[model samples]
Target: MSASLICELCPKSCRIPEGEAGDCRVRVNVGGKLRATTYGRPSAVHVDPIEKKPLFHFLPGTGTFSIATAGCNLHCKFCQNWELSQRDGTEMEVRYQADPPKVVAGALQTGCRSIAYTYSDPVVFYEYTFDTARLAREKGLKNVLVTAGYITPGPLRRLCKVVDASNTDLKYFDDGAYRRYSDATLKPVLDALVIQKEEGVWLEVTNLVVPTLNDDMEMIRKMCRWMVKHLGPDTPLHFSRFFPMYKLQNLPPTPVETLLRAREEGLAAGLRYVYVGNLHGGAEENTRCPSCGKDAVRRVGFQVLEMGVRDGRCRSCGGKIAGRWGA
Candidate 1:
């Protein structure tokens, strides 16, 4: 009999017997080897504005070819894409049979400046993302990851090589909230953020303010302060409004006022860029220069209305904007 294989991509480290899968459901132990079953078989693909990734600072107005396979390492109760992320590829109804080369070709065909491994956590489809990112980089396309940041350090470091930018969901400040709501811990995510920053991946943070879950004002302030101290004040922090979804349907949608308050806390904590997302038509969506208070970038729902940045600096104040502005 073959010995059990342990999947170490994430912190779960689930030991699986042959022919069975790990906690993520997509990684299978086959013939004594752990294999990513969803590799090269993405279930979701779309062309999205780079801003829709909520990646305000990285290549602001460009389109990103987004892709995601089935399965996610963490099971968050409020997962917006649970239908895809919570299931295996076999369980999913739609699986696009596109290999790394095909994916790169498609991105080129679509005129996307970057390829985003998003909709679900890219860490679950590590091998696929790595291969696609490598190919994309060779083709002069950048790579972006929209993730929960629940990856182990070693794998994350390897991933950082090809990933040019990322929007990591810092779900909450409390470990208890992580354990109860997401069936995961907080420390690894925090560690992953630090590692991504150290690796020089343009990092942005998103916090979904779920009502009665992670909406404590003090906790939000603490999270912002931590971001400023560790990841630096220039790290763009997006405060996303949470709507009832998946298992957290009992909760109401986060009020706009709540998102505003979170933005206030983030800005007050010295975060240079604080955005309110998932809610539309507001001043919070615009990127204002921290030095001169001029609107550096104006947007209304993923559409760039104006650009006031010149050579990665605010045109008015000449303050350096902390992002990859080069096309």
Candidate 2:
């Protein structure tokens, strides 16, 4: 009998050969069994505003119970959450022994409408996320994911069945850029986005604009253009500012001008909803009606300052806005 389980959860498809681990370093083969070492073991947990997920369209103004285990599929040098994402399960330092039922109870006790699998790549903690999502769904609670989207199609299909929405980090548009910096590829991510959208999961994209890495105006335009073509103009795109962190601390934070310019480029590429995040205040932080050009959803630093979307339509011109709006 072989200890390896023929790992195929992500594009890496790391073949663990008896007592070895996958690229994620958490999923390992132990005595002829493939097991997720971090299953039912969490390193981080919080009750966060749904807007903090940066998913404006899915259940706005609501609270979410967020949880994460250790390890990530990608090795992005500029990873903001690298302390958790880069470590193996044993090196996590903090741990919570929780199962699906406990996760559901936590969300209910916290008065959260959804549970988010975030902080580290959810793909590495698939068993935990899947079990929790199943329980959450049975309890009539929603599930959201904040992920790197570096996954294969089979597991992604299984995940989409339970996840109601996701905020996938696009990272960069260049395959060379991804391979060089993030230690991943681009096509599989695009495939995951398309599948999630097709599977009826509300999807949003976030691109962290590192100072000199992925903030090229031409590249930004190209990325936006592809989004408009495949994901539609209505899909919300967030151009988040990056500060020096991890291995890339030598460079200064992304200039405000660069973020604003990228926003403009996205708009020029015919993207209806473009946003700038990680900055305190900006007009691009608000959601405006594409047809009426009126502020549909207003925000002041992740707080919903005002919501002019009446039953998912613009209050000013009665133009239909794309997003989930529930009373």
Who wins the lDDT comparison?
A: 1
* Candidate 2 lDDT tens digits, 77-161: 9999999999988998898999889999999998999999999989999999999999999999999999999999999999999
Q: Which runs of model 1 end up more than 4 angstroms from their true locations?
A: none
Q: Where is the poorest 10-residue window by lDDT in model 1?
A: 318-327
Q: What lDDT tens digits, residue by residue, belong to model 1 across residues 107-173?
A: 9999999999999889999999999999999999999999999989999999999999999999999
**TM-scores of all predicted structures:** 0.99, 0.98
> Which clashing pairs does model 2 show?
3-32
For model 1, state the Cα shift of residue 171 in Å.
0.2
User: Which candidate tops TM-score?
Assistant: 1
Model 2 scores a C-alpha lDDT of: 0.92
